[model samples]
Target chain A: MALLELKSVSRHFGGVRAVDGLDLVIEPGQIFGLIGPNGSGKSTTVNLITGLFPLTSGSIVFQNEDLEKLPTHLRLQTGIARTFQNIRLFGQLTAWQNLWVAQNSPADWAKRGFFSRWLGGQSGVREEISQLLEFSGLAHRQDELAANLAFGEQRRLELARALATRPKLILLDEPAAGMNTEEIGQLRERILKIRAQGTTVLLVEHVMELVMGVTDRIAVLNFGQKIAEGTPVEVQADAAVRKAYLGGGE
Target chain B: MDFYFGLAQIIGVHTLLGLSAYIVLLTGQVSMAQAGFFAVGAYAAGMLTVLAGWAILPALAASSLLGAAVACAVGFPALRVKGLMLVIATLAFGEAVRLFFFNFDYQVARGGVKLGPLGGEGFRQIRYFPENGWTTMQVMLFIWIFVVLVMAILWWLDRSRYGAVLRAVGEDELAAQSVGINLTAVKVSAMTIGGAIAGLGGGIYAHYTTHIEHASFGILLATFALAYPILGGLGSVFGTVVAAIFVQGFLVEGLRFLGDWRNLLFGALIVLAMNLRPKGFLDAPTLRWIRRVFGGKRGAA
Candidate 1:
């Protein structure tokens, strides 16, 4: 049994099927990469998995429990966290503030009794937030608002923030979208380090070099359906994936 | 202590109002219906003291609670609407409430209020506490000011982990959900805080005035109350305090010109501030220099 599993999951937008009858399994401590071209339902699948948008049909079982009835933040409490394809940092707050917020108590306390939870005798939460800020290498920029960070540093902060939720499963949507070669290399190292800490990574990236270098396995989607799923070597050699990318010139 | 004594009547009420404005803005809302809530608190408190024979301090507390209750009721209509629509809802509600008070004649002093006639005595009697006199004022102002320090409590909330989720929602609701934040709850809580602050201010404002009138709370006054925290600076609690003082100063100084131009000048300055400094004049980089100038005046040399 895998740590996260999806069986025949589907979503539709009033006639356009964004994600159609998809099935996937992600094991613990493994680096699984999801790849597809534009309009291929990769992001939609992520949204469905995170419970941001409800699934039209089928089932998502996480840690051996059905997740269809769960809310988005509850899923985070269940140890699932994901970053966006586009950067969405809170520009007004400092980098450390970003990580600190992500490290907050579960939605239950924030929901039922925020004042008590926020102000109770618990001082440990504050200390924990401080430790995370330093761990993310953002201690220096703790007071500097998020807008002031450089591009690559912002990406790293995003990773730190996702990690702040202390998720067993971290989903990366285009973690290397706009990085230089050296930065991409550094990102590869960072993703590798994240995995070594016993956190499972499911990355969706278009950077073939990084993906092929880091991902143990790759899943390819072509127009709302998984066309290929195998080890990186088998995935690259698959005839259908080659045709989907290079338009059959291969 | 000397400054508090000098500023006396306004300090507590204005601070509460300013903090409310700050909370409303934190949730990414800009409300200008504070004058109406102030009226609500004043009338409720005044009526209870004068007609119901409630003690002054308790009456004030009850008034603030009444204001919050009214604001919560108003939330249903306003929350469903978004920007400009929400602003309109606030204004319409303010106007409707003012008229409701204006026409409310509860058979207190002389005859009860009369609707449509537009020329009848109001329901509640104007309270006058003599001898011990200013004691109620002192208690009301001091105790409520203590509550306003609860702004520190709000500051803590805004800085906490939950605060980050709210800010994420404020900055971008869709992305916040992706990170597992419930957008509706965050937005509503912020709005509720904004409402509660208005309640606090309303209670203080009522006790200070000792009488509530529709003429005192109109669309224009609501805008002024909302403007204070913004003009001071929305970034810090102290910023809101400075803004309230600045707005009060501007109103007095700007009105020194033409006798009839007070509203016109107030409107123009607020529009200028809203346009030139969307975050408010205090957040402007140049304001740091202005603060230094003021600090110098306070014997900082």
Candidate 2:
């Protein structure tokens, strides 16, 4: 069974079809890359899967469960976590607190009673939060407000925040948009490490270098439609994919 | 000494009101319906004690429950709207509550003297304190007891995961929702908690003042309930207490000699305070400095 499946999803904004009749299937434990030019419905696809907006027409199935009725938070509770393309950390909250707020996994609930889950102090999940901070290289900056962190640190914190949900599938929306080469390398290693842990990754990126170096299977989108689907080398060789990226003359 | 105790009682009750607003404000909601909850609590507790002949403590508990119930009901529809619309929704709710009490009449014969809320005439002679022979000092101390308990609970909540979640929701609803924080539950819970606090405060205010009119729970009181937390800073619960003291004890009481001119200074001073401390009186840096001075290492956030 697929980890996530989008069946002919179409979202229209008053006749402007942002995402028109798109179908996608992501297998469990697969690092799926979704690459597209600006306004190619890459973000819209992510939004639809995450239930940020209602689908104009289609069904999104996650872990074999239809997600038509679940709200965004409930969908996340079912183990679909995502990081925004633009960082959206709680500015007033500390970096540690950011991840602390995202610990909504079923396991987390089972670990503590209702009273402890909320009003109880952070002592129970201290180790888990610290580990996430360590993973993001933000342990030293944990006490600082997320807004005060550097841009790179903020991005890492946002990823860490998503991971805090203990998701089976994580979506990274242009996580490398403003990153330097070194940072992108680090992010690639992070994505591989995330996949190694048996959690599937959906990487949406404009940075072809990171996409080519990381994704196991790539899907190209143009004008809200899939233009190509293949491995990196196969996608690179595709004439249509080149035409979508380059120009009509190709 | 009596005047100081009276002032202390007012400050304590206002602090509760402020803390009530503080919890709701933490979720980035600017609710004006707090005064409505407070009014409900005041009337409920007063009627329970004065007419139903119940003990003050039990009456207060019932009032708090009623307040929470009303707030929960309002929260569902009010939270559906955002920003200024929420404010308007809450303001309308507050006015509705006020008007309900304004036209409310529940007087009953008590030893040949009518004793209950009469429409427009107001609920007078809530003599639980005076009749029980509780001194001004005693009443002030009693009010402070609940004030401290509320502040402590909120302080503990600030250190908990729920506190972080509330702040996260306040920071960004999109990110909060994506991270699986139920916006409705968190918001409604905050609203409910706020209602309980405001209700408790109102109960205390009824006993301390020994009277309450619908006019008292108007928009101005609602604004003050919000202002205390806003002016104090959302950094911690203590900010609300500090702001309540500054506003009630300082501005409302201390400047009384200025008479008619005092109201103008009150407005100007609050504006000035806001300008000086945009994040509230106890913003992050100031809180950090205070913590350092007090030999504490942990930051508020």
Estimate the overall C-alpha local distance difference test score of candidate 2. 0.93
- State TM-scores per candidate: 0.84, 0.98
Q: Tell me which residue pairs clash in candidate 1.
A: B42-B206, B105-B113, B232-B243
Give the DockQ (2 decimals) of all models: 0.41, 0.85
Evaluate all candidate structures by whole-model CA lDDT and list the values in order.
Answer: 0.72, 0.93
**What lDDT tens digits, residue by residue, belong to model 2 across residues A155-245?**
9999999999999999999999899999999999999999998889999999999999999899999888888998999999999998888
Off by over 4 Å in 1: A105-117, A120-136, B1-15, B32-36, B72-81, B99-105, B108-124, B128-132, B135-166, B252-254, B272-278, B284-301
Q: What is the CAPRI rating of model 1's predicted complex?
A: acceptable
Model 2, range B137-244, lDDT digits (tens) per residue? 999999999999999998888788899899899999999999999999999999999999999999999989998999999999999999999999998999999999
